[model samples]
Structures are given as structure tokens and as C-alpha cells.
Target: MSGKLARLQQQHDSLQQEHKALQQTKNQLNQELQSIQRTASNAIRISNERNDLRKQVADLTRNVADLRQQNRDLSNESNRDWFLIGAAVVIAGILIGLLLPHLRFQRRRNNWGAL
Candidate 1:
């Protein structure tokens, strides 16, 4: 009877020790899981920020392209305007040159007939 009682007490003590150890392991695992959850949350936030930056970069790229096109169009228009101005100046010079000679000849003829 004494041996059976001792055996039963030993078994109970062993089970208690095992339960304590298992509880410790469970607490450690829960802490590790919480740390992993925090890491995952940070990763998701960084990924969303990265995606937003990419969209901004894409929009800026398109804006730059549009600005470049506008600059080229303005340059072409300026060049055309300068060309037209130059043509107008040349035409005016030719008209002045031809009209001045004709006026001088007519005045000289009218003076000779008076002489």
C-alpha cells in the first residue's frame, strides 16, 4: 500500500511539471506570433507606400513628356513667325527700291519739258 501511494504521487508530480513546461512553451510561441504579426503589418505598410510612389513617378513621367511636347510646339511656332517677318521685310525692301527709281525718272522728265 505504501509503494502504490508513492507511485501515484510521483506520477502526479511528473504530470504537473510537464504541464508547466508546456505552458511556458505556449507563452513563448504566442510572443513570437505577436512579433511576426507586427513585422507583417510593417511590411504591408511599406508595400503600399512603394505602390503609391510608383504611381506618382508614372504621373510625373507623363507630365514631363507633355511639357516637352509643348516646348517643341512653341519653338516651331516661334521659328515660323520669324520666317514670316523676314519675308515681309524683304518684300518691303523690293517695293521701295522699284518705286524710288520710277519717281526719280518721272520728276526729271517733267523738269526737261519745262526747260
Candidate 2:
């Protein structure tokens, strides 16, 4: 009976030590899990920020293209207006050149008749 009692005591102590080691391992795993969660959270935030920046860049590129098209339209209209103005000036000059000489000859003929 004494021998059996001593053996049981040794088995109980061994079981207690195994339980302690398992508890320490559980605590370390929990700490690692928390660190992984924080890292995942930071990664998600960075991904969202990167997506927002890409959207902004796309919007800005569209705006620049629109502005360039508007500039081209305005330049074309200005060129057309200058062309019309130049044509009008040339027509007026040609008409004045043709009519002035005719008027001068008529005035000379009238002066000779009066004399």
C-alpha cells in the first residue's frame, strides 16, 4: 500500500507540470494571434488608401483631357474668325481700287465739257 501511494503522487506531479506547459503555450499563441490581427488591419487600410489615390489620378487625367479639347476648340474658332476678317479686308480693298479710277475719269470728262 505504501508503494502504490508514492507512485500515485509522482503521476499527479507529472500531470500538473504538463498542464502548466500547455497553459504557457496557449498564452504565446494568443499573443501571436493578436499581432497578426493588427497587421491585417493595417494592410487593409493601406489598400483602401491606394485605391482612393488611383481614383483621384483617373479623375485628374479626365479633367486634363477635357481642358485640352476645350483649348483646341477655342483655337479653331479664333483661326476661323481671323480668316473671315482677312477676306473682308481684301474684298473692300479690291472694290475701292476698281471704283476710284472710274470716278476720276468721269470728273475729268465733265471738266472738259464745261471748258
Candidate 3:
């Protein structure tokens, strides 16, 4: 009877140790699961932010392109205006050179007839 009782007590002690080890393992796994959840959430947030940044960059790029086109158009028109002004000035100078001398009056003087 004494031998049987000691064996049963040994078995109960071993079962208790195994239960404690299993509980510890369970706690560790739960912590790891929580860590994974946090990591996944952060990944999702970062992906969304990256997408938003891409969209903003695309919009800004298009805006810059539009501004460049407008600048080119304005510069071309300004150049054309300056060219016309220069042409008018040159034409006026040419007309003055050709017509100014012809427009001058001739001076006349009375002279006595020679025999």
C-alpha cells in the first residue's frame, strides 16, 4: 500500500509540472500573436500613407507641367510682340532715310544777266 501511494504521488507531481510548462508556452504564444497584430496594423497604415504620397506627387507633377506649358505660351506671345515692335521701328527709320531729303525745299537766289 505504501509503495502504490508513493507512485501515485510522483505521477501527480509530474503532471503538475507539465501543466505549468504548457501554461508558460501558451502565454508566450499569446504575446507573439499580439506582436504580430501590431506589426500588421503598422504595415497597413504605412501602405496607405505611401499611396497618398504617390497621389500627391502625381498631382504636383501634372501641375508643374501645366505651368510650364502656360509659361511657354506666354513667352512666345511676348517674343512676338517684341519682334513686331522692332520691325515697326526699323520701317520708320527706313522711311525717314528715303523721304526726308526729298522733302527739303530748294533755296532760290536772283542773279543778273551777263552780256
lDDT of each: 0.96, 0.95, 0.97
Q: Candidate 3 lDDT (Cα, whole model)?
A: 0.97
Model 2 per-residue lDDT tens digits across residues 1-115: 8899999999999999999999999999999999999999999999999999999999999999999999999999999999999999999999999999888543434566666
CA-RMSD of model 2: 4.4
Query: Model 1, residue 4: displacement in angstroms?
Result: 2.1
lDDT of 1 by residue, 12-108 (tens): 9999999999999999999999999999999999999999999999999999999999999999999999999999999999999989978845344
Model 2 global lDDT (CA atoms, 0 to 1): 0.95
Worst 10 residues of 1 by lDDT: 104-113
RMSD for all candidates, in order, please: 4.1, 4.4, 4.4
